[model samples]
Target: MTTVTTNKSEPGTTTSSGADLHLQNISKRFVDFTAVDDLTLTVPSGTFFALLGPSGCGKTTTLRMIAGLEQPTSGSISIGGQDVTKLPSFQRQVNTVFQSYALFPHMSVLDNVAFGLKRKRVKDTLQRAKAALAMVELEHMASRKPTQLSGGQQQRVALARALVNRPAVLLLDEPLGALDMKLRRQMQVELKSIQTEVGLTFIHVTHDQEEAMTMADTVAVMNKGKIEQMGAPRDLYELPKTAFVANFLGKSNLMYGTVLEDLGDAVAVDASGHRLVMPKNRAVAHSGAAVVGVRPEKMRVMTLEAEYSPSANMLTGTVLDASFTGVSTEYLVDVPGIGTLATFSQNMGQAPAQRGETVRMTWEPEFSFGLDGNEKATEGKDAL
Candidate 1:
């Protein structure tokens, strides 16, 4: 393995091996519309990084540019410290697995996996193809045709086909979109394991948030042709930097609030005339109008007669709706002035609130997150 030495690439700086993919100021335009706008990202070598966003958010375009399928209108792409922005698809050290799989219907799985190796006139095609199939745990099906295999098996074959080339980076553009939910989930784990075992950089483009969060070592949330935020899955989910990310990544109970005081350590907030408190460091904007968000599971429910704690943030509301999921009961509550707020209470043997019933929602002050007031929570609606 090549040691990662400190070196300045373009648009950003990082210490990584040549297998890392770097895109600096990359953009793509179609006439009056731009698909990717000044995008810059660095995927560390051998990491499972996911470009996550809704459809038409330029994730696919970015992957295409990296794979040399789509040329960027500006900027540069470097792999293993070599410039490949001007290179054709076949010339680049990258492999792509499309949603369609594109396997040869007439060929056996072993031949399908070795197709690229044969084209390149590589030696020991059969030997290498079997090795690749074993990586994806599909070695037993090498003799089967594409039509004879299940969707998951065929997807594994597609993966095997790409891996046989042993490219520096493998780009997967919704490669599991065709599988059923259960199988997609199973493949997500399998794909991540295979990438880790081979120590190959994998850049996955997907609209599925769960799949991305589940498999990606690092996730970049794309919005409107730009990266809204990027970090580890847990960090991005627990502390979203923008309203769009708060909503797009997961469910967020966004409530409009006014800052009452910024006391260095903690800030006092008032939402719907109900008092609230959040850490000052968590305040996106202090001493002004803001939108404070909390994850549903962070909140707890209490009876109207229960005494409130000054240290906890509390809201008074009427239960407008409730649905009992297996592990938790999701509730929609209507606070007088702040609108509807969602809460998820664990099913530790507690009855759900009924419609029109008055209730109180409480959560620790540390769990509340502040967002920019001017930006609507639906800022990511542009994605499909």
Candidate 2:
């Protein structure tokens, strides 16, 4: 028989707000191909975390391991202090919302939600299903079949189905991938609000960086079967640990240069023929090759007619192209020494700089990051 348990805490008792999830040295292999390699991560209780990476980067594999749907070659999985590495998918205190809603076409919304309880032979299946529908604000659609519902409605049914189980954690695999841009944005806000209301631990997997940034309280950037970096969205964007994380998470303008001097808390780089000083968190290899990374938004374009000194990290270039996005203006500047730099400016009722106009680009020193290798620089140059 299906068992439903109500969660309760004493009225003034200090209730712990979150569940704790831990994965230790998780590794999975498919014959000669290793899908996940020595992956370890700790997700705090009640946190909405995302595993983000391109396809075949092992994000889905890691989620499966956590769900107990796939056995890891070596590792341990724990949820709320209980070891669940050897448990079956059904035995784990977790639920999953797959990409496809997987609703029954012929069944009413009520019957579709009652399916889980019915499979387990719960005594009050109908009552529980109604309550679940209410949780997702779909109780009024109880008699409607899956075909009668909108895409967002179907997704809510899936969420209601998963939440009805009251699992300690919820795993979602690209649940919004199928929706259109407008609907996707709407769902992002809805999902985040729902999660906050329920205070359930959620681990979502996706290749869309914006989705991850928008929905997750914490983000793990995965690459080549390994987690490159993990942190809050702002932290990862402002202080990226690696070049791959910087480039993959958002658009960045990478430059090739050699370190000219290490100025205690900052390092000066000779970018092509121009010298630029960047904030240094660690002592980078001085007097050697380096790569400087800067986000496109960090650059501001100034025409020759505009009044600005060349004291900052300034580069003169011709505007190769200008594209007007509603919220911002994007420019492609062809500079003599550093090649072409992609620049962006906010659209505050101002006209975009005209193409082929000579403009000066400047950025703050703190906005640039210095890395030792030339791989990212080479890749950026090749892309242009």
Candidate 3:
């Protein structure tokens, strides 16, 4: 049963700059396929939150549900303190900016911004539109059609339109997907600046890890219709809780091993008779075949004779490939029993190891993490 309620904001009325958005066990299904499953998240007021995942993940579906473009299959959504689960798009205090500019080619920039206000029959539409234009720094383009403006300018116009209403929540669904790489980066900075200036709740849905890390105050990493993990960008990168997050958000070199001892603060593991140590909290299970994870940049590779710390975890491998990309050198090493591993070393005036050379790798035990060897990061991210 569905009930429709008229919860519209009064004409010419804009809510406060921000309001908390809450979702309780939200799910979306299409026939036999499930897009989102039992997802619950709380986005604080005046925050920049990002939902990040791959193409088939439920990030976009979650955003559409918030915008009322798609209804949830179960559960309720609330903004501030009111239940908005059954409300229509116009009845909710939120607006969305899509990847497509969806601008009117024949309409002037000023008129485009004014259209929403005019529909609501608000007083002084022209004045408010100019104010919004000025906020986006496009006031001078008021008389020009959208066709005459550059891609970035047109994007700014769309942002101005959505923001002029002062909706408590501004939903951005890949708003920078249409811009070139350079412009996309530029817009990322601009958008964050604008969101901070307005103090509105911004929920941005995207698949780009770097973009989310660059702009979002908090990031929720999604995978296979569920949230894999959520945290600050640095936390997710440095201390991932799942193999999926470890691989998807950035690069990780995982080595499978069996647990030998569980120290109070760290766990000892044996990978093909070579002992390794990792922080205890990172172990998903108490014992058994576990996986040890280390970021490529954390492990150091040296010639067989170079002196390295004897207390740290060490492994030897034959360099399968080596490539230098100016700032850093990447190496692919093949160990006798632990499979292939990738490592990166910064080029601080030191020569890189050549391919086919025997090298020893060492890293601090604290930098290594223990994970469930059975978990597959490749799941759901590949072709069906």
Candidate 4:
């Protein structure tokens, strides 16, 4: 796996046949509003990088700029060591596989894959197209028309079409958005494997968090045209840097609090009349107000009558709702001053707590994270 870096690469040092993609102080402004702010990023050669965000978050615009389909209103774009900001789409050595697939119904799969090569007057187009189809495991369907193929098969053909060109960079703009859940997941694995085998720099744009996390080596979460957070999937989910990331990437139970004490190794916060503690390294706000957060799955809920560990951060509340989803039971508990907090308990055959039942939720203090108190608590609520 090639490492994804935000730092600029040195001149004359090409990491792979595939080029590193860089955007320096990029911005796109429309007459009505600015679509992308001053954004800067570097995708290392041969890395599977994902630009993830909700709709209108400038991910697509960014992909378009990279593909030379749209020009940045300001800043520069470089692939490898060459600037391509003003180049036409065809001159950029970049190809895009869009969500719509854009296949011609009249053309056979082989013809579709060979179209680009044929347009470029390349010799041995048929042979290269067949090789591409084989790479996608659709060589047998080469002679079939796209209209006769399933959605997944067509998507693969679309991929094969783009791969046959051997572009320096491949941009995937929600390429699997149209596939059903099962096929989408299956394609995610296939796409990752194909990318690994080919060692091509891929920039994938998607709104689905699962899609981004499942396939990309690095994920950049965008909000309102700026990257809110960027990191490995596990790191971003475990230690979010902002309230928007914590809430949008997954479910986080956050409560407003004020920092009370800073122990050498930890920080204590008074949250809703309860003293909660988090590791010092995990605290973003050392003093004044803060937002204390924990993932639902990390919290353990039980009846108040049960014995509890004195060192754990504990909250007593009444169950507001309970939902059973086979593998785990999700409970919503209403704690005084803190509002409702969600908890997920694995179903170890014990019955789920009933609504209105008094319960105690406890978790290790180390599992908690602290964010700035000024951040909007619902900044990214229901974003997914």
- Tell me the whole-model lDDT of each prediction, alpha carbons only: 0.86, 0.82, 0.86, 0.90
Q: Write the per-residue lDDT of candidate 1 for residues 173-223, one digit (tens) a residue.
A: 999999999999999999977876787788899999999999988888888
- Say which candidate scores most in TM-score: 4
TM-score for each predicted model, relative to the true structure: 0.94, 0.90, 0.93, 0.96
Error of 1 at 260 (Å): 1.3
Off by over 4 Å in 1: 1-18, 381-383
* Model 3 per-residue lDDT tens digits across residues 1-384: 111111111121233378889888899999989999988888877778898999888899999899988999999999998899999999899999999988888899999999899999999899999999999999999999999999999999999999888899999999999999999999999998898788888999998899999998788888878888887788789888778888888788887888999787888899888899988876675589888889999999999999999779999999999989888999999999887899999999877899999999999998987778797745433421
Model 3: worst 10 consecutive residues (lDDT sum): 1-10
Q: Output the lDDT of residue 141, model 4.
A: 93
The list of candidate 2 runs beyond 4 A from truth reads 1-18, 282-287, 309-311, 349-351, 378-384
Ranking by lDDT: 4, 3, 1, 2
Model 4 CA deviation exceeding 4 Å by range: 1-16
Return the clash pairs for model 3, or none: none
Per-residue alpha-carbon lDDT of candidate 4 for residues 78-178, written as tens digits (9 for 90 to 100): 99989999999999889999999999999999999999999999999999999999999999999999999999999999999999999989999999999
Q: Write the per-residue lDDT of candidate 2 for residues 1-384, one digit (tens) a residue.
A: 111111221121233344788888888999879888987777777778898888888999999999999999998999999999999999998989988988989999999989888988999999999998998899999999999999989999999988877789999999998888998999999898788778888899999889999988788888778887787788788877667777788777777888888788788888889888888773234558877878899888987777764556877899999998878999999988789889889987765789989998888888887666555553212111
Give one clash count per candidate, in the order shown: 1, 2, 0, 0
Cα lDDT of candidate 3 equals: 0.86
